[model samples]
Target: MAKMKLRVGVIGVGAIADEKHLPNWQELEAEGRVELIGVCDIVSERAHEMAAKYGARVVHTDYKKMLADDKYDIIDVCTQNRHHAPITIASLKAGAHVIVEKPMAMNSAECRAMIQAAETNKRKLMVAQFMRFEPDSEKLKEVIDAGRLGTIYSANATYLRRRGIPGWGKFHIAKESLGGPLIDIGVHVLDLAIWLMGCPKPIAASGKVYRMFGDREDLCNAEWGEPYDRKEFDVEDYASAYVRFERDITLTMEVSWAANIENERSGVSILGDKAGISTSPLGLYGYENRSLTTTRFDWLPPQSGHRMEIRHFTECVERNRPVRVKPEESLRVQQIIDAIYESSRTNAEVPIKAT
Candidate 1:
């Protein structure tokens, strides 16, 4: 007479888990749609604390133990970039759908492996690309799908923080997080931009990275988080890339955790032959009646993209329908990231092999 509740487990009870993933999943638990079964983290105290706070039935320091201990219907992974692939693959093989944090994994190879595991397991896998769930993004996508912005050719994604390197986590450590803002905040805007542009196949990328202020000793880093050792900061704070896609489509991206700028600026702009659109002000620009005109939204629903993203994943899992953020699409984004890093290393354009 009643529906069964989906059991959910969460890995990596860190800041992102606490702030975004856990709170939203807990809300779903309250709605009787899902049960928070287990919370896992390397730090046992954090695991126990989140388990108690979120009404999870169990706590685990090791994710393997968590997978062995219970059969979860869904596993939300909020781990570091390097652990995304392994944890997600393991969770999928263990008979649970997975939703991992953005940037997917450390490299394209890992992304492909994760996708394969999901395919083999017949489970859903989704990336938490929260920006795509925003109201403005949804509206813009509708306009684009309707051919309002005809023949989309190029786009630009920019995310720059004046002096905002993470002072807290393993973000500055290259071995732990892969790279700096490119893989960090850069991935967010880049993924959103490409998704809005209809996800063209990226052919090649040319890029460069710079470790400007992150590794320095004399900079003010008090605003971000707790202070960390300067010697541990080895990743690039800034990255720039130009990516070429199929059908001559192109995208240029610039991201920095620290830079010399008037203020922090972040937005994605899509250019088309007929018209153009920008995300910051949610506006469209083009010529109307032989005169330039701009249409700006005076109001849009202010919904939390993270909450919407979590709900979307849960609904897709429940209905056994396709997820909004498909693994193949995320793999493409990972491919672009890999090419950019390789291009930076060789100081030449790197081709993105088809996967």
Candidate 2:
């Protein structure tokens, strides 16, 4: 009959599982669907060098002993942000089907206990929000799901990196990346500006965070990697927020790794009464014949939003179908990053409670 394959497994072989989920799960294990078996890492030589560079027959430094030794259908967590809810709730109670990485945990009560351990183990819980698998965010989410961006509201998420303070790993260590650049790269442009405004339900947030230049010591990061310890730089190189969603939808965020910005900038811009979009030069702003138009994107297909977000979560777990990054929309982007870090620790305005 020739069907069954999907056995994959991986749990933090670092640097985003060596640059984006083990080279796209070794290209879906050379297209015979899947079967990387295992690879974990508390650096047992980076879990045997990423399980001998991704062929992955097995190697773990205890992800609860690789979930009590094998039996995965799929579990690629790329860990950090505090072991994404206890290794995705112990790999969904050891039955697998998880895809963490993102600001999906370390808040929102661990994203509601990793979505209640993937809904009491029915499994499938994705959240690698790779900017919604960007090709200019899937052409502005197909022109805002074809209503042409009408009635959306507002957005503006920016990611700045003028001094790029990521001197490799544990990103300035707020107990291992819980905050900084608003949960790293501000949870990727605030989860791509709240999934391009169609996921609205954030309720509230107002923020502030800054540490100037990564706890300085004559700072000059010299190209981001290996030079960390300025007393282990306690997080927050910059962050700013203002979110509110559900019907009246609004968002405004700014992230940074170190600022005084002028060099690296990131995008996300939405605002629709009828049209408005922007994701770094892939634009559209409207008023068609009443005359204030602007649309761009001369050509698009250059895909690799982390290899189409690990090939759309391995084709929605091989066609059981339904995971375009939803874990209740990453627990509403981790409840607006736990209400912008409890509104930057009680400066006020925090509300957000809508899992």
Candidate 3:
């Protein structure tokens, strides 16, 4: 006998849906574990294209209409940074669970509001901080759990790219897109490092921000495809932070859209009492393995970060198990991100109010 399939609706059929979420859920549908039902986008054409391409039964341009359409077991939100809170709250109030992308909301306050709604409504809210589902990251988690890294002391997580700003509109320098690479890319490293370190309470944080190659037509670091509003470009292109945890552990994070580095540094390396482990773009490190020490996945997973997270969410809904990445845990990531922004502005160490 087989189990019942979970009905899932995905909101925002944009690049992330077409590229990551839809394809991932499609694979789950193929495996007969979940039923892909609805897809919504602000642009009707995109919704239609995704529904047609993926065989979803329902499609809507308005998110409210989609939320009101049916009592879906899971609503996967793949929208921009600003829209996460409203849509998530509405879905929760409508009695449906939510799975949203990371930097959970525009700020820590929005994150708190969404969590409150979910708690009041008794619905599951899972933020897709997709890195936790990556094979390498999971392996690193296992390594730590096995106590191979014995009493991890410090870590450095980086998401540095050399002039590789995104080639989309507003994502580069638009605050309405909710800040720059710090929230856009830094959130992942911050969450990954903190999670790998047992989600320690971030006690204090200090950050530095710079706009080295920004605010000009000729100095635009991203692609020359979109007509950017030179006057409206007001976000930082580079951000770095230092964090101290309550457990006496510390972590350093560096993220950037455009930098002078030779290449990208997209990994987290934790130095422990016994050994050191590092991973990037692939599997985890088993620094204590006799033959495979200090080397994590030599090859990458065949799936994307969004895939693993979606699968975990769907399965958690099906089994009534806890969301692998809890809303509270994800909210902590947003909390740190907010602090980084504040610390950058004040040029002082900002204390994290929430544990």
Summed backbone clashes in each candidate are 0, 0, 2
lDDT of each: 0.92, 0.83, 0.81
Q: TM-score for model 2?
A: 0.34
lDDT of 3 by residue, 1-355 (tens): 7887778898888887788888888999999987888999988998999999999999899989887777787888888888889999998998888999776988888988999999999889998888888777887888788887788889998999877666654575454567888888888887888888888887788888887765656764544343566567688889888988887899998988878888777888887877777775444444444565445456655666777788888878777889888788888788788788788888889999774
What is the lDDT for 219 in model 3? Answer: 66
* TM-scores, each model vs. reference: 0.98, 0.34, 0.91
Which pairs clash in model 1? Answer: none
Model 1 spans with C-alpha error above 4 angstroms? none
Q: For model 2, what is the alpha-carbon lDDT of residue 82?
A: 88
Kindly list the per-residue Cα lDDT of model 2 for residues 1-355, writing each as its tens digit: 9988899888888887888889888887898899899988887988898788777998989899888877998898887788888898988998888988887877777788888889888989888888788788888888888888778888899888887887778778888777778887788788877877768778888898878878778888657754778888887888888888878888888888777756888898988887888888778889877888888878888888888888888888889888887888778787888778777888998887785
Q: Lowest lDDT 10-mer window, candidate 3?
A: 280-289
Predict model 3's lDDT versus the native. Answer: 0.81
Off by over 4 Å in 3: 1-3, 220-227, 281-303
Instruction: Identify the superior model by TM-score, candidate 1 or candidate 2.
Output: 1
TM-score between candidate 3 and the true structure: 0.91
